[model samples]
Target: DVEKELEVQIGMKQEMELAMQMLEKDICDKQDVLVTFRQQLDDVQSLNHELSQKVQGSDNVIRQKNEIIARLEEKASQMNCTIKQLEQRLRQTQSSCQSAEEANYLFKQEFGEKILRLQNEVDLLTKQRSQLEMGLKDKKLSLHSDPHRINGSEQVKADQQQMADMKKELEQLREENLRLRQAGEESPSNGIHQSSRSSAEAEKERSTLERQNVICKLCEEEVSVTRLKRRCHNCQAIFCSQCAINELPLPSSIQPVCVCNPCHRVLLQQYSTTPPP
Candidate 1:
């Protein structure tokens, strides 16, 4: 019985040693798990710090972009206003140009009509002068043929009176011819007396042609428009008030509504019975 009791004691001692070794291995495994958890926590903290820095940079970029957009919008508004002002100025300039063109066209039309009328009058005067020259030649021939008939004192006296009248008419004709020549020599473009040019120079000419329907018989100059009193529409005659009173013919016995001289008798008369309103 003593041997059996000793064997039980030895078995109990071996179990106690085995239990102590298991407890030591369990403690070492728990320490290794705790170290792994701490390393994972450190990695998470580093990632969070980097993420916060990226978010801050993104916010700053957004703010700068918004400011740039605002500036661009402001500049666009200014450009739009400038464009509108330019359009308005362009429209006004076009209107002014159109008005100027219209005025120029009207002036040109009036001047052209006056120039044509003046040319016609010059042609009529030239024809009259030519006819007078023919008449003078005929008179000279008649005078030469009647030498014997004009030898008597009474006959000579009559011939002298006729000759004097003819001389006066001839002198008037020469003066008229000289005036026409002078007018022809004066350039329509510059109003200066000059030689004639070829047809090509006509393209470059700028003339201001004026009309004159009235001429002074004594001075042989154009009558002043400011001093004109009566105008004959048919003959286009402008006469001073005194000249019209003295030159107009009067009826002998019967009183006529209108009295006209020999030159204007055939023309349609427009008598001014009253002053202009």
Candidate 2:
């Protein structure tokens, strides 16, 4: 009985030792799991810090972009204002140009009417002078034919006084003609300065005048009929058919063109000398 009791006690001691070993193994496994959990927690905290920094950098970039957009918008507003101002100035300039054109047209019409009236007066005066000259010649012939008649002697003295008066009137007419010519020359220059702002505009006005058939340069008469007027090829001067002195050959044209006396003289002087063969 004692031996059996001792074996039972030994078996009980072995069971206690096995239970302790199992408890220690369970504790070590639980510590390893805690260590792994701690490492995972540290990794998660580092990832969170990196994400916050990235978020802050993105916010800073967005703010800078917003500032640039605001500045660009301000610049756009200024440019629009400048564009409006330029448009207004352009409109004003156009208005001024139109007004200048109207004034120039009126000035040209008035000047043309004055020239036509003056030309008519000059033609009438010339006709009257020719009639008076013929009358004086007839009176002189009658005086020579009838020398002894008392009435004829008195008539001859009266005709001599009339001739002296006509001479004075002719001198006055010549002076008036010179004054009118000088005025005509100065008028165009004054009109150009007052009305034209650009060379292109002045050229356009001159072309318009040429197309309108204003006057003959030689006769100072209005050139209303195309058939009666001729233009010189060399000098581009307009003259009446009666005033044209000759026809000249031009390299560019097939037909001969009429020329004024001055241009014909110039051409003769230029080509009269024979070339060396």
Which pairs clash (backbone N, Cα, C closer than 3 Å) in model 2?
none
lDDT per model, in order? 0.47, 0.62
Query: How close to the true structure is residue 41 of candidate 1, measured as C-alpha lDDT?
Result: 79
Each candidate's TM vs. the true structure?
0.37, 0.42
lDDT per residue for candidate 2 within 1-277, as digits (tens), equals 9999999999998998898898899899989999999999999999999999999999999999999999999999999999999999999877766665454344334444443444345445545655666786887788788877778767767866776776677566546645644554454322323222367874674455456765778768776543256667678877765456355333344233556766655544443332322
For candidate 1, the 10 contiguous residues with the lowest summed lDDT are 251-260
Best by TM-score: 2
Off by over 4 Å in 2: 1-19, 115-277
RMSD of each: 18.3, 15.6
Output the TM-score of candidate 1.
0.37
lDDT of 2: 0.62
